[model samples]
Target: DQQVKQNSPSLSVQEGRISILNCDYTNSMFDYFLWYKKYPAEGPTFLISISSIKDKNEDGRFTVFLNKSAKHLSLHIVPSQPGDSAVYFCAAQFGGNFGNEKLTFGTGTRLTIIP
Candidate 1:
């Protein structure tokens, strides 16, 4: 069962606060992980990614941590802004399997930033 799961359907945070989103997966073969942010009626934009080899990866305001042993991952956004409000998708790719590198996405989490 190659399934990526986001338990929470939504989250809300005040501006300038921290926002945390969680994800889980059941597939053992997944090697590459990615987080994507999507705005209303728009395609998802890549935020951050971590390979199974690494435990964490960080960008300017975004960070992603992977726990391979637990088959879990999370995304953190600091100083959350109103502009940061959108849907977040957790995706995983199976590296070794050809054509299996396609991203398997979670149901998605909608994050809202309150001004």
Candidate 2:
């Protein structure tokens, strides 16, 4: 029932400050991970991703870190902005699932940036 978990339900951050989000997984078959941002009515959009082989990946103000031994991953946002406020979801994909392409996701963390 708890294959993947997002410890934080919500995060409040001040504009121009740093926002941290975390996730943990119990499955080792997952070889790829992704972060998605979703608005109220629209569909979730792909934000960024990292391979299990990499420890850290960064793009602009967003950075994702993966720790295999701890089965933990984190997303760091520096200088948080109002536009960045949204429900962020973390998803995982199993490797060698050649015929079937599906992603398992952890509960999303709603991020609020105070302006």
Question: Which residues of candidate 2, in runs, are more than 4 Å off?
Answer: none
Query: Which stretches in model 1 have alpha-carbon errors above 4 Å?
Result: none
For candidate 1, the lDDT comes to 0.93
Q: Write the per-residue lDDT of candidate 2 for residues 1-115, one digit (tens) a residue.
A: 8778898999999999999999899998789899999999999999889899999999999999999999999999998999999999998988775754587899999999999
Provide the overall lDDT of each model, using Cα atoms, as 2-decimal numbers.
0.93, 0.92
The alpha-carbon lDDT assigned to residue 3 of candidate 1 equals 94
List TM-score per model, in order: 0.95, 0.95
Q: How far is candidate 2 from the true structure (C-alpha RMSD, Å)?
A: 1.0
